[model samples]
Target chain A: MVSILGVGLGVAALLVVQTVMNGFGEEHRLRIRESFGDCVVIAKSPIEGPDVLIARLKADPEVISASAYTEGPALARRGAFSGVAFVRGTDPLATDQPVRQYVVAGSFDGLDDGRVILGIGLARTLRVAVGDKIEVWSPVMAEQAEKGKAPLPASLEVCAIVRTGFTEVDDRAAIIPLRRFRELWSLGERAHGVTLRLKDPANAVATAARLNVGKAGLNFIPWQEIKKNFLEAIRFEKTMLFFLMFIITLVASFSIGSTLFSAVIRRTREVGVLVALGAQRWHLVGLFGVQGLLIGALGTALGFLLTWGILYFREGILDLINSLFGNGDMVANVYQFSKVPLHYDAMDFVVAAAFTLIVTTVAGLVPALWAAGRKPSEAMRDA
Target chain B: MPKVVLQATGLKKSFASPNGPLAVLRAVDLVVHAGESISIRGSSGSGKTTLLQLLGGLETPEGGEVFINQVEQGLVTPRKLLGHGVGFVFQNYQLMPELTALENVVLAAKIIGRSQVEGKARELLQLVGLGDRLRHLPSQLSGGECQRVAIARALINEPAVILADEPTGNLDETTGKEVMKLLLEVVAQRQTALVLVTHSREFAEKASRRLVLAGGVLSSA
Candidate 1:
């Protein structure tokens, strides 16, 4: 029973931790895809006709949607608040669907002349709201005209406030018309890149490989490849947690060995009887080994069931916990989301089960050997 | 010449005790011919049990050689020798409490690579008057019945030699005699060599050859 608990707890912890880790990675990747599309295509030199390339890519069945965008640093000043932000210039009609789907408030429109969209977080910090007038300055535009001069100022109206709920993107970002941004930056109808959405998010890599834009002179980057560091970190953390929790299972198996050893010592005569009846050492080994395996398997199964139960009602449980503790910021702290988002990975469950079985089998070794190594005469003498 | 089934020469054994190295057996020599039932009688401290242990390969002797079926004891690994065919029956009837009498006997046959283990175990159990109690475990059986199961287990592999150490010591006199009778009857059917250790003179007298251990030597009687 104790051995079962040990193995079960180990499997349970490994699965839970791995599932959460995978969920975290998947959630982040999804957000990146939704915000940046499945892949981004950038030109070696500013492509001459990016619209033509977009039309060609859109003709491909693999490509779901494509939109041209430009990005650069800009300073927005309003009263006492002045902060630098990444100003992304995107077409309100072409790029708004995939990128602005996560926008919690305000619509993406009104880009007729000097209108812009500001992230809610950035707007709050700048103490500005929709319809508020703000000054936009770019050093690149200033440098083009004369060196060491203050940036060229462009008076812009805050057309909308978009809340993406991502600190990295929402804290300091704004969107505007790609044409207006091109004119301001003096780029002359050139775009920084085009973001491509795929029919299947999982097929992003294959689709990236199939993207043949030889004449377009563009290089494509899959969203997964772009976030390789983050993905690797998540996988590494999950692996570390798996082994770390497996130690508990190993310790529990030791308890099983101890218990079996004691049982052998107490049942010396019984062992002698088997030996006397022509039972080989292997037979004794197998008998006790099977016992240990059963203990481990049972424990692992129980733990899996318990883990499933916990994961099944995780929302209610968390809510109950919140009711008691008065929710502070666990979701934001742990998952960087407003609530816990979980994904149950079957592969993680298999890994946990396999690891538990191995540990249990290994733990059975000492006891099995002890029982097998005893001489029938010695064992029977105890009778 | 008679076929020799078991032979031991100049056997010696000693164990470390708190006081000193206690000599259990010294220079013990014995032999048993095929199809012969020999009874070895000795007092409790006369190394009767130690000598039996060495003969059964349960303990290594300090000095001596043991041969079963003319195979050099040292040349054969103890485990392999046991698998080949060595049967032991303890006085206390050491049956596995978890296994039924039928399972206990069948397991022995299976380990020794005997085909039709279930059939053989059933036949042996019935011969020992345990046909009705085949499904009973050691815990469920009487002391005498448990001993009978142990006897059935010992014969499961059709071993060449049968060694019993005080086979009837744990039973009442009547039950002890009955067990002895059944043992002799089974051995006679197999025509195997039998070596029994007993304190009862009556039991010893039943054997074709009887040896009494005294003064560190077996004297024929």
Candidate 2:
């Protein structure tokens, strides 16, 4: 019975770990899908050309919103404070995606002017915030201006503070306007690229297909495709984890096998009796295997029920913890949500339960065969 | 005169040992008739058990064929023959410890496709005087009581023949006699051939036909 408990625990732990790994990967994918629309159409040509192309896209019914963006690697400096940064220039009115919802201070309307929006981390590194003046310098722009002599100085003021939790984007990037970016880059009639928000993300393939310009000198790649490498890695890891965890249940199966073997050895006389009484070899095998099946079914059912029950009350438990801590917003900062985000998938439960049953049944083999192999007289002789 | 129920001719069996091939049964011939109780007696290691196994079709003979109920034992696999017509009772009271006495009997009845398994299981248990202990597991029963359950299991199928390899070998002398009495009574009631293998002269003498097996063959004495 204790061994059953241990086996159950081993199976449950493997299932839970697999589930969490799946959840983590799914969480990231969903964040990306929700953050960036299914695709971002980037042009290698000048920024203004893409801005003009975006206008045509915005008029299309399938296009939700098409916004031009100017992004480049540069240095953000304020007095002696200098930190390297990547600046993304967007039409604020057109590019107010939910990812930009974390604007902390100042007006998003200031992007039309020379004022820039800075991420909290970038603002902290440069020691500046909304209403603070900062110099934006790009080496490409600096080198181009020097060729013409009398470099263009675009001294900008930070007007909005945005806090996106993603460290990759939030800690290193700032946002400006499309026109100001073209001015900074000394490009004529060209915007860097157009980011399109589609009516339905799943229609990204169709949308990219419709936007295909055979000789247009630009690529419209879906966000999913761009991040396919990351998604594929996660998928591979999940497969590896599944097999690795199955090994735990396999070990538990060895226990079943050993238990059945001992049962067969001790019950040799009883088996002989059954054989004498007209029991077939397969019948004896089935009988012992059925016992194994019962144990596995009972243990798996109990473990899954326990797991589901815990998951069911998990929200209440979190609330209790939050109330005990006397902080209503405690969970928000820790898990980035007010509630524990647990998604229950029926497919996940079925796969896990079925897998456990197979493992347990395989464990019953050795002992069943041992019992069936005994000759009635040979077993009876021992008695 | 009874009709022959089991026949084996020149049956031979051997086992691989460190020394050489140890012949357990060598060129043996046996015949058992329906409604007749035959006792095979032999000293230990004298091939008495081997002869019984060969006659019962429980083990395949190295060189010859065993026939049960006019069906060639080799033609019908051992498992099929055992399930359909052969009823065996081991000396150890080989009752399944996990199953109740009722379940043990019901299992044999179920195996042979008998009708009214519950009624038959109950009737057999009653025949062995274990009707009250129907639900008792083998572990809960005494040595004699377990043997009674084994007897009940054997008769549940109404087999064409019954094979008992020292059915009372583990019981006290009195208990053994009582068990033998119950076994003979049940076999008589079912009209099944009874083959009893034992070293006990008391059991051997009770059989309608007594044979002693030595040097790999049986001869009536």
Candidate 3:
């Protein structure tokens, strides 16, 4: 039972931690994909026919939807509050569901008609309530205003506040209709880049590789390229955690090795009797070996079962824990998630089982060989 | 010459002590014919157990060799030693603690590929007056009962020679006498050769041939 607990706890901890890490990784990946699309195609210089390019991009079976967006730096002002924001001009009239799903408040329904959306953090800093007007001064047009020219001063009512939970996007971002942007900046049919959504977000890298963006004077960037550092950190941390947590499993197996060794010492006289009765060295080896195997097998089975049970009831277990603590603050405050997320990958379970069984079996073999090598005369003399 | 069952020739044995090499037995030779009883008497630390071990092939002699039925015990392993008919009964009655009296008795029988000889094991245990204690583990049995179980185990293989090294050394005098009597009767009935090493004169007197091992040499008592 002690051995079972040792192995069981190790497996359970590993499964739970991996599930939590995977959940967090998935959450971040999905948010990034939903906000930025699976992949984006950028131009080295402004392309003349963006509408035709978008149509061509969407023609591919892998491409779900394509939208051409224009982005530029603008100094935003609302009454007495002022902040720097990157004003992104998107075709709000196009019913782009990928970007619209990230809206935390209000709607894009009236945005293309007469309003603009501010990121939640920018709205907080600008101190503009929903439906209030904010003025934006374009940096390119500011030089003309400084030379005694009438500047293109743009003003629009707030339509929505998008809280992506991504600080980089949320802290300095805004969205306005493309028609309004073209009118204010005196720009004609010019787009910064095109965002392309794919049927499978994970295929972004592969699709980007196949795309010949060099011919079009464009550079294809996958979603992974945009968020490489964060994802890689998570991957490296997960690998390190697997090795670090496996120490518990290692310590647990050491107990099994020592216990079997103690049993060998205690049974020395009996072994002598067996050998004296014509039992071969191989017989003794097989004896201790089988004994260790049985113990290790029992421990491994119990550990696997315990971990499986814990993982199966993990959500309910979290609920029970939350109820005990009288709050759902754990998911909201700690992880910024609505609920405790768990990803149960079958491969993870297989890896854990293989490691547990292999280590334990090897642990049992060491002492078994030691006992097998000893002469029966030692036991007899001790007796 | 009624066929010798066990023979030891010029046997030499030594141990590495802290001071120097301590010789236990030096150039000793002996022979025991089938169904013959021989006794070796030695004082404390006089190498009686050492000689018994060398003869049983439990340990290799520093010099010379042992033979059972004229088969030289070369590269003396347990399988070869026991296959040529040698059984051992230790001073501490080495019955496995986890096993019952019956299981202990049947150990030798099972090893020799006579697993079906459980009935014979039961009969032998019954002969040693342990019929009721067959299901008792060694921990549950008395010292004398444990010795009886060892005796039954020794005779299970029907080996030609039974090496009794202080078989009654750990038992009280009364219990010791009872165990020794059962041992002699059983071996005589089976017509098996017996070599006993003991410190008791009365026990040594029972053997057909008695010798005293003194100063690393076996001499007539």
Candidate 4:
């Protein structure tokens, strides 16, 4: 029973951690897709005839929508407060504008050449709200000033506020009309890039690769490539955790081996009797092997039941732990999630069960071999 | 004139001791026919048990061969020798403690790949006067009862010869007498050969042929 419980607890711990990690990964992916779309095509210089490129891209079967955009770093000042911000210029009237749904205050439709949308963190930093005026200077204006050609900073009204729930974007992003960006940068009828939303975001990498062919001076990047390091880190952590949790099952297997070894020693005489009664050596080995398999099967079954129970009562269990530790609302405060997330993948269960069963069965083989190695006469005389 | 059921020729066995190799059985020869009972008496440590083990093929003799039912024991597998050729009853009644009396008896049949022997096992238990204790485990049964279960287990496969090594050694006087009587009666009824090894003169005298083993040799008692 103890061995079974040990294996059960180990499996439950591994599965729970894996499921929660998957949930975090999924949530992060969703937020990233919301902010960056499925794929982005970037150019070294402003793209010429962007409308033609957008039309060509939209003609592809995989492309759901494509819109021209311009983005760069800028300095923003509001009264006595000032900060550096990433400025993105987009077509406000585009049907697939991703930031439109994230607008928390005011209206994205009001954005024009003289107005802009501020990310929630930037709005908080600047202490500004709707209808407030903010001064912004492009990097070109800074370069002109360095060359002794003084240029005035553009003054735009804050028409909306957006909170995309992605810390990197929400912290220091500002969106303005595309015409406003081109006018400020002294560019004519050009855009920095075009963002594409595909029919299946999971196919972004393949779509980006296909679209990059024959398109000179434009680099197509998928969301996965954009966040490769973060995703890989999550996967590495999950793998490490799986092996670490398997140690518990390994210890339990050792317990099973120990118990069977003791049984062999205790029943030395009985073993002799069985051998005298015509039992082959392999029969003794099989007896102990079957015992190990039974333990593994029962333990794995109990582990699955434990996993279901833990996931079902996850909220209450978290609440109890938090209350005991005096860390109320830990998930919300640390993870920015209102509740713990769990994602069930069938592969995780299968791998856990297979690993446990194989380890336990192999563990039993040691004692079984020892038992079968004894001579019947030696066993009887010794006992 | 009866058919020869078991034969051992020039049997020899030795053990390695701290001083030197000690010879146990030296040039021992024996033969027994069907429906015959032979008892070999010896002092403690006289290699009586060693001789029985060698004849039953439980121990490999260094310089002799055992034949059961006209087949040399060395030529065939030990499983065949112990399964269909001979049966063993140990001094301590070596029954599996976890198994019931009936299951222990049936286990011998199972070793020979005989599956449909539960009814025969029950009948053997009843013949040994253990019908009421068929469901009792080894730990629950008394010394004599455990010996009876062992005897029943030995006869389950109906081998041609039964090699009993002090089957009543652990029981009291009255229980030992009862167990010996039951063993002899059952072996006689089945017409199976029996090779009995004991230290008791009374039991040895009851066999058809009585012999005494000493100085690693067997002589008429």
Candidate 5:
């Protein structure tokens, strides 16, 4: 029973750590995909006939949707508040835009030639809400004003507020309609690039490579390339944690081995009697091997249950921990997640269970071999 | 012309001691026919148990060979010999402590690849006067009852011979006498050869043949 509990605790600790790591990775990926589409096609200068390029991109089987967009740095000012933001102009009529899902305050449909959408953090900085007006000045307009050819700032009403849960996007992003952006930047019927959503986001890098081949004056950038270091770091950390946590199960297997060794010593006479009664060496080995297997199976089952219970009460447990440690919002402040996330991947459970069972069964075989190797007469005499 | 169920010739075994190699059995020879009972008596540190082990193929003799039911011990695997050819009864009543009396008896049959022997095991237990204690574990049974369970276990597979090594050594005098009577009665009824190793002269006298092992040799008592 002690050995079983040891295996159970080890399995539970490994699964919990692995699932939590998976959850964090999934959460970050979801946020990145929400703020930026799977890939973006950028040109050296403004892309002429962008609608043609968008239509061609949408024709591909892997492409889910494509929207031509214009983006640049701008200064946003409302009343006494002012902050620098990246202004993005997108087709107001496009329904399948990735950022449309993150509209928290108002509807994305409200965006038009005279309206704009503000990121939650940008709105907070400018002290504005839906129906409030803010003046936006492009870098070119600022340069014109410095040359005394002063162009009036474009004043637009805030129609929506989006919180992508990514500080990079949420803190400095403003969206306006494509026509209004063209008028502000004095570009006619041209866009900076086309952002594309794909059916399988995981294939974004490959799709980008295929799209870039023989396409002149355009560079396709996948979302993974945009955040390669961060994603790779998460994956590497998970792998290291898996091996580190596996040590617990390895130690538990040693406990099982020790227990069986003691059992062999204690039952030396019984082993002799069994051998004398016609039991083969393999039979004795199987007896102890089955014992180990039973322990591993029961422990793995208990560990799965423990993982479920922990995931189910994750919020309450986190609250208790925070209450004890006096860092109630540490996850939110450090990881940018409101609560601890948990993602269940079937493969993780299978790997952990198989590894533990193999280790424990091998551990059992060591002592079993010792018992089977004993001479029956010597065994009885020793006992 | 009774069939020879067990035979051993020129069997030799030795153990290593601090002083030198201690010869336990130099040249042990024995033959037992069906339904014949032989008791081997010896002093402490004598080779009585070693001789019994050699005959049963539990110990490999450095010289000579053992034959059980016409099969040579060194030629065939010990598993085949021990499983179907011989049964063992140890001094300590070596019943598995975790198993019930009935399971302990059935385990012998299982070891011989004979399933569906619960009825046979139950009958054997009843014959040994342990019908009411079949569900009891070894720890729960008394010394006499445990020895009875061991006897039933020995008879479960109905082997050619039963090798009993001081089976009643741990029991009281009254219980030992009863266990010996039961063992002898059961062996005779089944026509199974019996090779009993003991230090009791009274028990040795009751056997069809009696021998004493001394100085690594066996002589007629």
Candidate 6:
């Protein structure tokens, strides 16, 4: 039972931890896909003649959607409430669709009518609400605004408040119409970059690398490159976790080995009897191998059950842990998300079960070989 | 009138002693025919059990060979020896502790890849008068009862030669006599050869032929 439990614990940890980590990685990737199309074709400076370039990109079958986009540091003010945020500008239909999907308050309907959408965090920081008009100061267009030389839209109405659920992204962005971005920045019918949504997000790397965006003097930046460090860290931790869990499983296998070893010792006379009764060395080996596999199989099955139990009440479990420890935003900060996700992959179960069975079978083989190697006379005499 | 079913010629076995090699069975020979009962009696350490083990293929002799069912061919492996009509009954009643008495017996047929042996196990158990205790593990059975199970196990394959190694050594005199009577009766009914090793002269006297093992040699008694 101890051996079974040891293996069970290791399997449970392996499944639960791997799944949760996979959940975090998948969730992160999804958010990146949603927020930044599949990839972006970045330009060092605004493309002066982007009409032909944008049309050419849209013609590519792999490009699901494309948008002229711009972003820069901006200051927003409503009465005494003032805050700094990244003012992201996109075509009314281009970024408006995503803003509408995530909008928690108001609507994106009036965004092109000299209106802006603020991320929930940015809205809260500026202490503004839907229908409120806020003054804006742009670092890139600051000289033109002070000299009154450029007819910039000095006040933009807050049409909506969106919460993307990613607090890091939510805390910084204020979405504005791309036409206004061009007017404020003194650019006419051009954009700093274009965001291209691909049919498959993973192909963003290859698409961006091979795309002929240089015709417009535009460079390329794939989303994978944009989020490389963060995703790589997740992958690295997952691999490290797998290694650590494997060590734990190996340790459990040792317990199984010792149990079988002791069983062999205790049943020495019985083994002798078996051999005397016509059992061959291979038969004993097979017998012990099956015994170990049975234990491992049972443990893995029970561990799967345990994982189900854990996942079923995952929210409550996380809540309980947080409440007990009284660590504010503990899970949110560590995982970069407030909630824990349970990823159920049959492949993981298969791999874990196979690894466990092989380890335990090898563990049992040691004692079985020891028994088979013994002469029946010696074993019988010992008893 | 029974033809020879088992034979061992020039069987030599020894152990390494501190002073020198301890020659146990220097030169031992035995022959048992079908339906024949042969008893070999010897002092402790006279190699009587060693000779039985050698004949049973549980141990290989340092020199010489053991042959059974001589009508067939090739050297006998311990594994093939069991299904090739050879059986063993140990004094310690070495039935597998993990198995029930019936499973212990059924194992004999299973080794030879025989199916439908549960009924055979049941029959053997009934023959040994443990039909009601078929599901009882070896630990649950008494010493004599365990010995009876062992005897049933030895008979599962209807072996041509049943080697008995001090089969009654662990039993009381009364139980030993009872077991011996049942054993001889069964062997006679099956027409199988019986090679009984024992310390008791009385038990040896019951066999059709009695031999004394001394100084690693066998002599008619």
Using Cα atoms, each model's DockQ against the true complex is 0.45, 0.48, 0.58, 0.75, 0.71, 0.51
Report the lDDT tens digits of candidate 5 across residue range A56-80. 8899999989988999889999989
- How do all the candidates rank in terms of DockQ, highest first? 4, 5, 3, 6, 2, 1
- In the predicted model 1, the residue pairs found to clash are none
- In model 1, state the lDDT of residue B62: 88
Per-model RMSD to reference: 4.3, 4.7, 3.3, 3.1, 3.5, 3.8
TM-score of chain B of 6: 0.94
Question: For model 1, how does the per-residue alpha-carbon lDDT over A1-383 read when each residue is reduced to its tens digit?
Answer: 76677667767776777677677777887887877779888867766667888898889898888888888888888888988878888887764455455455556656545888888778888899888978878766668658655555888888877755567677778888888888777778778988888888798887887795464467888888877887788778877877887776667777887877786787777777567555778888888878877877898798898788777887777878877998756766444575566788887778777767776766676778887888777777775
- Best of the two (4, 5) by DockQ: 4
Q: Interface root-mean-square deviation for each candidate? A: 2.5, 2.5, 1.8, 1.0, 1.2, 1.7
lDDT of 3 by residue, B78-166 (tens): 33766338878888887778889999888778876676878998999999999999999999999999999999989988887899999
Model 4 over residues A1-383: C-alpha lDDT tens digits?
77778778877887888888888778778767878878989888889989999999999999999998888889999989998889998888888777887788999999998998999889988999999999998999998999999899999999999887667787789999888898888778999888999999998999999999999899999989888897798788878887887776788778878877887888887788788888887898888787777778888999899989998998899999999999988776656566788788999999989998897777777888887788788888788
Model 2 TM-score on chain A: 0.80
Tell me how far the alpha carbon of residue B113 in candidate 1 is from the true structure, in angstroms, after superposition. 2.1
lDDT of 4 by residue, B91-198 (tens): 898888889999999999998789999999999999999989999999999999999999999999888899999988998999999999999999999999999999
Give per-model TM-scores: 0.84, 0.82, 0.89, 0.90, 0.87, 0.86
Tell me how candidate 6 scores on lDDT. 0.83
Candidate 6: segments with Cα more than 4 A from true spot: A49-52, A74-85, A92-96, A99-136, A140-172, A206-216, A333-338, B16-21, B74-80, B98-100, B118-142
Model 5 chain A: weakest 10-residue lDDT segment is A328-337
Candidate 1 Cα outliers beyond 4 Å, as residue runs: A41-49, A56-62, A109-115, A128-160, A180-188, A199-232, A246-249, A252-267, A292-307, A320-329, A332-339, A342-351, B18-20, B70-86, B181-192
lDDT of 3 by residue, A1-383 (tens): 67667777777787777877787788888877877778878877765678898888888888988988778888999888999988888887676555576677888676864688988889999998678999988876787888999975677889888777688778788888876776666668878788888887788899987774444578888999888998899888888888877887888878878887887888777677677777777787778777666666777677667767876887788889989998876776555567666677778878887887777777777777776676678876565
In model 2, which runs have C-alpha deviations exceeding 4 angstroms? A1-18, A30-37, A47-52, A102-114, A129-131, A138-157, A163-168, A179-190, A213-215, A246-263, A288-359, A366-371, A379-383, B15-19, B70-79
Which candidate achieves the best TM-score against the true structure? Answer: 4
lDDT score, candidate 6, position B45: 95
Ranking by lDDT: 5, 4, 6, 3, 1, 2
Candidate 3: which stretches are off by over 4 Å?
Answer: A93-96, A99-102, A107-110, A143-147, A213-215, A309-331, A380-383, B70-79, B82-84, B111-114
Residue A179 miss distance in model 5 (angstroms): 3.7
DockQ score for model 6, please? 0.51
Ranking by TM-score: 4, 3, 5, 6, 1, 2
